[model samples]
Structure formats: structure tokens, C-alpha cells
Target: MAAEQGKVDPMHQFAIEPLFGSAHWEIAGYNIAFTNSALWMAIATVALWIFVAGGMKRELVPGRWQMAVESFTGFIDDLLEANVGKAGRKYVPYIFSLFMFILFANLLGLIPLPLALAGVHPFTFTSHFTVTGVLAILSFAIVLVVGFWKHKLHFFSLFVPHGTPLVMIPLIFMIELVSFMIRPFSLGLRLFVAMMAGHVLLEVLSSFVIDGLNAGATFGLIVSLPSFLLMIGICALEILVAGIQAYVFALLTSLYINDAENLH
Candidate 1:
């Protein structure tokens, strides 16, 4: 209906607009400007810093904030250390920060305010690829670092299984190598896709909710009802996705590091 009204942009779903552009810095011919992605990332960083800092002052009988912080970090730290062993303790900060950043970014979007309300920068923070893509690359780099640190010359053996036949060695090596290379791609794409997809659903539903009220069509009312309900459902699921994706990314990174350490 909004499509018929000609108010909605068809390609607004994936557009990442730059706030301002300049020759601030260049990497690989791409100029680094203050973009929406960068802005939200900064917001995420500041928000996380403040949120965690507020809980940093611990007491013997911890308050809600202190307890929450302790529990959150303890859970991730324990899980990683248990599965990945003592060496994995080195990654506690990285994993914990990743989970917290994503959780804040996801929750930030759920802030209820009028769509036309000024001073709101939802687009800057939500589902921005540059922010997420860099995070993915960071995970990839950590795996590489840990693998090399632990296994030295033998880490390359990850490309070949221990019991593979000589005839199948080359093909298996290629397969494992490709799969290894694709981990970052899969990780980044999954999180970015989930964030983007969820926001798109929310926006489309909101459009229906608005248009239905305007048109007074019975079908519009029906569509709007489910759209509102689905928006609520997606919001809840997105909260889970936010934390889970961050955890999965960290978990996989730790496992890869462990594999590099064990090399078997």
C-alpha cells in the first residue's frame, strides 16, 4: 500500500548513507569518512563503556549492576576456558566485549520513539555492514594469530586430516583450506544479514501499521495487526540473536584457537 502511495524507497532496505565525506584517511582507495556505520559503532562503543563502567565498582554484597556484570563475564569466560582450555583465557576480553557490543547495538534499536522524532540516529547504529564486517575480520585475524602462536610450523596441517589417504590429500587440503577461509565470510554475513533482515521486517510492519490507519481498509487493519504482532516477535527474537550471534562468533573463534593449539 505504501508502495502504491509512492512514499517508501524500494532500495531503502540496504542503503548506507554517509554522514559526511572527506579525505579523512584512505585504505585501499576507499576514503574513511564519518559514515553512519562509524557513527553507530562509536555509539555502541561509548554505550558499552558507560554501561559496563557503571557496574565496575564492586561490593562484597553485589548490587544488581555488579552482579549482572560479574555473571555475564563469568559465564562467557567459564564456557570458553572450559572448552578451549587455559590458553583460551587470553581471549576473555575480546569475547566479552564482542558479546556486549552486539547486545547493546541490538537493544538500542528497540528504543520506542516516534519515527519522525528528531535527534534519533537509528540508521547510523542498526545493521551497519562496515561495523560488523570489521568485527568479522578481527575474529578471523585472532584465529590466525592463536593458531600460529600455538602450533608454529604444524598449524598448516589444519588443511589436511590425520588419516586421509595419499590419493585424496590434495582434494581434501583444498576443501579444508576453502572452508577455513570462508569462516569470516559466513560469520560476518550471518550477523549482518540477521540484523538487516530484522530491521527490515520491523520497518515494513511499521509502514503497514501507519498505512492501514490512514486507509481504513479492513484488510489493512488485518495486515497491520499481524504486522504489529510480528514486529513484537521479531524484536524479542532479535534480542536473542544479538547475544547469540556474538557468543557464537566468539565461541567459534575460541574453538579454532583450540584446534590450532591441539593440532589434531
Candidate 2:
């Protein structure tokens, strides 16, 4: 029981550890460690590929699986079209991939897996700022490049309102530029904060249940019942959050692109 108390650290799951234990290596004078975060990222990528690519087919009369896949495709298509107008057609594939990858990464952490093999751990990539920061930066870069490619110097006008006073123009530009630069960090932070909080909450609840069961008393079991039920409810909520965060990330990216294109 003391060992269990020692092991039940809620924030321990977020720690990034090397895959090769202490057998560390360096390439070109840089420490290139294969961490648990990398393992789960690769897992999420392969799972996404198997799910989406393996399911592709050509059939006029679609089966249930095919229908579900098509529905997802159509849903993303509509999202792109609605948010970015006709120009958004080119971005459907990118947005769809981003959404699915994030959804898979977020949900992978909720699974209670024994990852002790080969120096691995249950990792939620999206819960880490490093992972989410890269994703957000990539999306922001795409919006910036495409905006300038399509509109050139006119893209700068995104900061200025349609009818701003001459005196306020410079102030508005500074404000807008600051907000624009903050978007990627904010996007990444939002996902990381939410994922980290949910997982920690689950960990704390599970620890209580564990302690109760270890007690081996009727009252312990009785109290643990409600804790178990609460964990179940939290699991369901986390699932919903997983999907919603993916959708929200994609939606916000699309909206940013829309603003860049239309300058509103």
C-alpha cells in the first residue's frame, strides 16, 4: 500500500522518457533521444493510415464502413467550403488529415495500456506543448504563406479595418499583428492544457479507487462505487473532448485562412 501511494503520481504520465532507457546516443553533437512521445506519435500516424487508407474503395452502392468514411469526407468538405469559400477546396485534404491525426492522438492517452515493454509509456502527444506547438506553427505558416502568395502586400491589410481613422491605423496594425502572432501559441496551449487537465483528473480519481479497493472493507467498496461511476462519466466526457478539440482546431485554422483570404 505504501508502494502504491508512492507510485500514484498524477503528473507522472506527462514525463517524457527515452525509449532506450539509459542507452543514450548523439548524432552530429546533438542528443537524439527516441522518447515515449515519439513512439505514441508514430503509433497515432500508423493507426490513422490504416484506418483511412485501408478503408478506401470504389463502389457506387456504399457499405456501412464506406458510408461512414464518405460522411466524414463530406463533413470536412462542407466545413472547408463554408469557412473559406471556393478557395478552400484545395485545403480539404490537409484539414482532414490534421483533424483525424489530432483526434487519434488525443484519444490514445485514455486507453489504460501497460507500456513497460521496450522502455515505453502511455503517451498523449497532443497533451504536450512540443507536439501541439509544432502542429499549430505548421498551420499558421500555411495560412501566412498562402495569404501572401494569394494577396501579396494586400495581406498586410488584414490588420486594418475597412474604415479606421488615420490616427488609429498604426495602433490597430500593432494590435492585430500581436494577436496574429499569438494565435499559434494560443491554439497549441489550449489543446495541451485541456488534455493535461483531463488526464490528471482521471489519474487522481483512479488512485482513490485503488486505495479503496486495497482497504478490503464494505465501506471502502461502497465509496469506491461512486468514484468508479465518476471515472466512467469523466471517460465519456474526455471522449467528447477529444473529438471536439480536433474539430475546433481544424475549424479555427479554416477561419484564420478565411480571414487571410477575405481580410475581414
Candidate 3:
């Protein structure tokens, strides 16, 4: 659909367009062509690398770039230490990369670039459940592997909390096990829904602004003005939400790892 049609189709932003000309690579009957989502993810990865690389310049007096990187490193370090104690330190590299990757991806999607002229647009891969689900599963898999490897069969004890009544052990174990299994779904859904909802709302309000302004002066003043203001507020809120979601994902992952590392 044309950009003009986006005023009607709020979901146009979320469409996954193949980068190549209508050609899809298929293996085992599944299409896996290069897409805008993959492109954006690659862009995010490169951006992150540049950001970290810039901060790698060690100096006698640390510059803003170095300080900024150190600040984030310390923040993640403290978060993991608080959650999983000293053992959590080992997982800092993974957790930090995960947090920064999500943060960069979320923020990159919100950039209002003038790429429309180039037939290019910013895409939020995180808005898709597949992307988020893979991330969640990665974290969950680490927890499972670590738990089973370190604690052996005792990892199952994580499902049974301390001081449970003997009679309620069966019921509590079932409930806890179910909840444990649901973690990946919930983790993925939370980020996906949050990102998608914010973008959809912004698109809808943008459409209203365009339509109202095009209609008449009265409509522009009554509808477009308010919608424009609300859109600005939502844009700001979404930026904040972007960071919060990254933090929440990393924090929860650390906490989950704590269950594995310490069995608490």
C-alpha cells in the first residue's frame, strides 16, 4: 500500500516486506527471505557495535563516551549482583548485550527519519512476536541448561517453594510448574504487545491529524490540534517505554537466572 493509504491502514507500519524483488528463499516449505525486519535487526546490531566501540577508547580522564558505556556496564553489573549475587556476575556479558540490543532496536524504530522519499522506512522487529519469542527462549534455555547442569535433578526443586505444606506440595508444584513453563510466552508477549500497541496508537492518531487537517479549518482546530498534541505526548512516552521494556526484560531474565543459580 502507498504511504497515502497508511492514513486508513494503521497496521501498514508493521508489514514485513521482503527486501528483494518478490523472491523468497524456502527450505522445508518455509519462506525465509531477507526482509525489512532482518535488515533493521542487522542495523541495530551494527549501531550497538559502533556505540560500544566508540566507548572502548581508554583515557586517563574518561570522556563522555567512555563514561556512558561504563555507566551502563555498572548498571547491569549492579542489577545482576543484586539479583543473583556474585554468581550473577558471570552472566553480565550476556545480560548486558541482551539489554542493549533490545534498547537499541526499540529506540531505532521510533526514529522519524525522512526515508519515505527513498522508499525505505524504520521497522520495529521487536513488535513481532517471533523476534521477542526467540529472545525469551534464548534466556529460558540458558536458565534450563545452567539449572540442570549445576544442580542436576535438584533443579526441579525450584518449582516447590520453601515451607510448603506436605498436602499442598502436589497442587503447588503443578501450579508453579505451569507458571514456569509460561515464562517465555509471557516475556515475549509483553514486549511485543507494548511495542505494537504504542506504534498502532501513534499511527492512528497520525491518521486522525492528517484527515482532520485535510477536512477543514474547524476540524483541524478541534480534532487535528488535540490529536497532534496527544501524539507528541505518546511519542515521548513510547521512548521511555522503550528503555523500560529493555530493563524489564533484562531484570526478569536475571531474576530467572537467580532461580537457577541459587534455587530461591
Candidate 4:
């Protein structure tokens, strides 16, 4: 049933609708449901595979896919080298993967059908805060892991300022520690909130436009159309944000790791 009819369960909005489910099918006692996110992920994987495979067997002069992939790879390489130095080269794969996953996910959501699916189920298990939150925390953990792994106990000394008063050492350490702990929280919140709020705003604005048109109020309809258009522009902006947030997460992570490796 359509969401407008109220027959759809709002809480089930996040549930993954599989192509089919059967009594014999299971994965570790968990129902292996096929979700839109998973579908997008699979699509991303296939797209990446095709791009990479094609790039490998390209002509002497690059074709469209080859050039596009090379350009993206080179752009990332340059960004890392410029920002984090030669040492940052090692993290290129991880950063690239993060950026691609996020970029495709955001792009896929822009498709009308996927956007409609989101409205159909708002309270599904998949809609829980955990998925995106976990992704953010995972990224944060990678940064810290790389940092401390490279620096050892010396990494702990990061909290001590280079030229602080002796009396302020403890306070500085406390503040630094608290801030460090909050990194994951902030990272996760930023992505989750952005995704949720952007989707909600788009949905609400669309509803307003429809309502305005139905009411026969010319000004309201006109204004609502612009608002709807603005939402579309914002959706495009969100695509950029997805790529940016991924890059920022990786870059900051590289910075932290660099500091640790250098014992700074």
C-alpha cells in the first residue's frame, strides 16, 4: 500500500524488501533480507568492477571510462599527496573506497524510485540509527587505530601541548581526551543527520507543493514550486556533500595518523 493511504507501517519503512523470502533461507539465524542499501552497494561493486576491468584493457589513448576512472584516481592521489605528504599514499585505497561507497549511495538515493521507497517505510529495522552510526564509528576507529599503531605509547603524549604552563597540563589532557572521544560521535552524527534531515526536507517540500496546487492558490503554488526546485538543487548539493564528508573523514584521519607516526 502507498504511504499516503496509511496502510503501510511507518516503522517498517526501513525494512529491506527482498526479491523473495523462504522458510529454508537464512544466514546465521538472521534473515538475509535484500535491502535497497545492499542493492546500491552491489551496484556500486559491479560498477567499480566494470570500470576497473575496462581500464585495464583500454587502448593506448584512454577511452571514456578509462579516462574518467583515471581522472578520479589521480585527483584523489593528488589530494592525498598535497594534504598528507608521501606517507599518505598508503591510505589511498581506504579513502577511495569510502568516497566511492558514499558517492554512489547518495547518487542512488537521488533516483525517484528509491526516494519513493524511502517514504514507504519510515520505521524499519534498517532505518535504525545503528547502520550509519556504525559506519561513522568504523571510520573514526580506523583513524585512531592507524594513529596509535604507528606511534605506540608516544601517541598518548599528543595531549600535552608543546609550550603549555606546567599547571595546565592536566586540564589540557582532560580536554584533549574528551575531544578525542567525541570524534566518532561527531562523525557519525554528521552523516546520519545530514541524510535523515535532507530526505525529510525533500519529502516535506514536495508535500507542500502538492497541497498548494490542490488548494488553487496561485501564489502558494508558485512559491511551492520554487521550494521544490530548491530541494532538487539541495539534493544535488548533497551528492557533493557525500563525497566531501568521506574525503574529510579520510583526510582528518590521515592527519591524525601522520601526527601519531611522527609522534607529534
Candidate 5:
């Protein structure tokens, strides 16, 4: 094991350890307990609330905080309107919350605090498939609910394009149906993999930096310097990726909702 050998384990960051005692609340043979992942998620949710609440002051002439929030709101509004048209206005609240939650969660994970000295480290819940999968399923469920509620059985027609020959109907329907079903998995996997990969890379580089320094000054100069610099660059890239992933998830969710809203 990397840890036993006095080396950093890149994968150790992803471990889901309980925050409380070792004993977990079990129901039907499954352990359910508060964890670092849950703690970070709760923190992100609270942070989002504070951010949005500060902006809700409703100044006659908006301040910087209000302006920042308005800018994000407008961005999502425009995205929804472009994809789903006027009806999208009603869904703005849901979509906006979703986007902000994800954005905050992603950003929070990258915060380098001194908590490690207190035996705490920031946890990125989005890197976990369980977290991402639940978010994806929630979005997908909304699409299904809205589609069925609004269009009833006609929603099934979404799998069939506007134009297709009778001979190709079966093949096209199966293909489209399969693609449709894969959306949730793809959406969740995208965020999970992106977050996980970035953190793993950072951890590995951090190990190199530590090991190189401990080995010798020459090795440190040769390996640690370059790795440290690359880590900085990668950290910057990861921040951008965090934002982009949130936007992509929101955009794709909006697009999927468009299909439910307009049968596109």
C-alpha cells in the first residue's frame, strides 16, 4: 500500500470515511451515516444559500455581489430560453438552483484550507459516482415527469425524429431510445470522471514534489520544480474545468428538458 510505504496515495482522497464514530447506523444490512462527502455537500448548499441571499437584498442600483448573482441568473435564463423558449422561464428557478449548487460544490472542493492540520481535508463529493448519479437521475426524472404530465403518451414519440421512412422506423427508434436512456449515465460519468481525474493528478504531482524534495536537492530541482509548476497550471485548469463542467451539466439538462418541453 502506498501509505504503508510512506508514500502518498492518490486514491486515498476518494475514500468515504465516516465523520462520526466507526459504528454506522444500519438499516436492512446497509450502513447509512454522515460522511465527509455529506458534510461538504451540506457546506456547499449553505454557501450557495449565503451567496444567493446576499444578492436578494434588491438594491435600487445593484452592488457587485448583486450584479454577480444577476449575471449568473441571466446566463442560465438565456441558456434556458435559447434551448426551451418562453416556457423555460418557469423552469429558471429549478435550473438556476441546480447550476449554482453544482458550481459551488465544484469550487468548494478546490479550496485549500489549513484544516489538514486538524485532521480534515476538503472533500469533493461530485467526484463520487453516487453523488453525480443521484443528481443526474434527479434531472432525468424531472424531464420524464414533465414530459408525461404535459404530453402524456405522445412523449414516447420523442425517440422518433420528425422525418424517417417506415422501413427505418424500428432501427431509428431503437437507436434513439438507447441514446436517450444513456443520457443520465453519460451526464453523471462526465462530472465524476473529470473531478476524480483532476484530483488524482494533483495528488500524484504533490507526491512527486514531496518525494523529490526528500530525496535530494538535485532531484528536487529536477522533478519537484517542474511538477510543482505543472501542478499550479493544472490547478488553474481544474478551476476552469469545475466551472465548465457545471455549465455543461446545466446546459445538457436544459437541452434534455427542451426535448420534454417541445418534443424536439
Candidate 6:
């Protein structure tokens, strides 16, 4: 149902609205003010800075904070080494950066801010294609540049697997080429859709429970209880999804780099 008459709109949370007063910034009569999405992005960037920098101190005896940071970093390091091998260690910092930024962006969206704030800026910019797409493009660029830089013409061999019959080579190359070209889209879409869907599901479920309670019937209250519990479960699952999506993105990046560097 449309939210025009005060109905719940799960998607309204994803809208892009002006960050400040209207008419403050415009071009040719079109309002182009800074958006909440932009503000959240800036916030995420600042948060990343504070967390990473603050946790960089090397303590003689690591405190809980220090240990937590070290553990997270070690996990990222292991992910890189597992997917991309020893040479991949060189890209650890970059991979770790990608993972943490995405992980935080996903988690931030789960925060239940005021309805007014959420309507203007949900703070889960990663749920938007533009943000995720940019990251995907960056990953694609790294793979492309590294592929060509390391292998020259041999990089094209990535589109052709080994141990293939001569007759099937042409068909296989086309399939691989198409898959390779759309990596960025797939990478970004996976995260963007997953984040958006999880949030929307939670909102829709919560609305159902609220509507049930408002019905003023004993059965409504009982029904709402189960729905409420389900909503809580979904929230927990989204938290897990947030981490998994970030890991998949980073792992895919590492695998792409590996393929580019060590192509068959």
C-alpha cells in the first residue's frame, strides 16, 4: 500500500531527500541539495577513521579494545591469505579496508534511529546501488589493472580455462567473458539487495505486529507476539548477513585478483 495516507511504507526508508532546508542549493530550478545518504556516507567515513586510528596503539599488554581490533584484523588477514595466497598478503590492508567499511555500513543501517531521521537518511548507504556499485567498480578496476600489469596479453587467458577441447574453447570463452564483465554488477547487487531486503522485511513484519495490537482483540495481541518474535529473529539474521555479505565481497575481490595474477 502507498504511504500517502499514513500507511506503512517499508521502502520510504530508502528515499533520498534533501539534507538541509529546501531551496538552499539548486541548479536550474531543480533542488540538488546534499542528501541524507551523503551525510551518512560521511559519517561512516569518519567512524572508520576514529575506530581504525584509535585502535592502532601497540600496547605491551593488550586490553580488550586492542585485542578486539587485532582479532578483526587477523580475521581479514586470514581471509586474504586463504583466497589469494601469499602474494595476496600485499593487498591485506586494502582488502581489510573494504571489509570493515562494508561491514560497518551494513550494521549502521540496522540501527533504529528516529522515524524522521530514518526517512531522511537511513545511514545504511550500502543498501543503495550507487555506493555499492562504486566499491564494485573499484574492485573491478583493481583486477583489470593488476591482470594486465602482471600478464600483459596473457591476462586474456583468464577468459579461457585450461584442459579444454579446441571445439568448445570458443563457447567457453564467451561464457567466461560475459561472467567476467558483469562481476561488478553482481558484486554490488548482492550486497545492495541483501541489505535492502532484510530491512524492508523487518519493517513490514513490525508493521503487521503493530497493526495487530491496534486491532484491540485478544487474538490480535497473541498474533502480534509471534510476529514480534519473528521480527527479532530477522534482525539477528540481518546482523549475520551483514558480516557474510562483507566477507563475500572481500573474498570475491581476492579471488579476482588471484585469477588475474595467476591465470591458467
Q: What would the per-residue lDDT of candidate 2 be over residues 1-264, giving only the tens digit for each residue?
A: 334555578888888878867337788888778887888889999988877764587578887777877888788899999999998988999899989889999988777645545545668989999889999998999999988998999999999978999999999999989999999999999989999999999888877887787778775678677888999999999999999999999999999989877777
TM-score of each: 0.86, 0.90, 0.95, 0.79, 0.95, 0.90
| lDDT minimum window of 10 residues, candidate 6 | 113-122
Query: 217-254, model 5: which lDDT tens digit per residue?
Result: 99999999999999999999999999999999999999
**Could you tell me which 10 consecutive residues in candidate 2 have the lowest summed lDDT?**
112-121
lDDT of each: 0.75, 0.86, 0.93, 0.65, 0.92, 0.85
Question: Which is superior by lDDT, 3 or 6?
Answer: 3
Residue-level lDDT of model 6, residues 79-136, one tens digit each, is: 8788777888888888889999998888877877475465534568888998999999
Report the C-alpha displacement of residue 111, candidate 6, in angstroms. Answer: 0.8
Assess candidate 3 and give its lDDT. 0.93
CA RMSD per model (angstroms): 3.1, 2.7, 1.6, 4.1, 1.5, 2.8
Candidate 6: where are CA atoms >4 Å away? 1-4, 22-32, 113-121
Q: Flag regions of model 2 displaced more than 4 Å.
A: 1-5, 20-23, 113-121, 215-219
Q: Model 2: what TM-score?
A: 0.90
Q: Residue 89 in candidate 2 has what lDDT?
A: 86
What TM-score quantifies how close candidate 3 is to the native fold? 0.95
Residue 69 in candidate 1, Cα distance off native in Å: 0.7
Query: Which of candidates 1 and 5 reaches a greater TM-score?
Result: 5
Please provide, for model 3 over 1-264, each residue's C-alpha lDDT reduced to its tens digit, 9 standing for 90 to 100: 556553568788999988876346888989888899989999999999999998899886889999999899999999999999999999999999999999999999998747755777899999999999999999999999999999999999998999999999999999999999999999999999999999999989988998998899999999999999999999999999999999999999999999999997
Residue pairs that clash (backbone atoms under 3 angstroms), model 4: 11-123, 11-124, 13-121, 13-122, 14-124
The model with the greatest lDDT is 3
RMSD of 3: 1.6
TM-score preference between candidates 1 and 2, better one? 2
Evaluated at residue 238, the lDDT of candidate 1 is 74
Candidate 4 lDDT by residue in tens digits, 114-138: 5556663222121235755676677
Residue 130 of model 6, lDDT score: 87
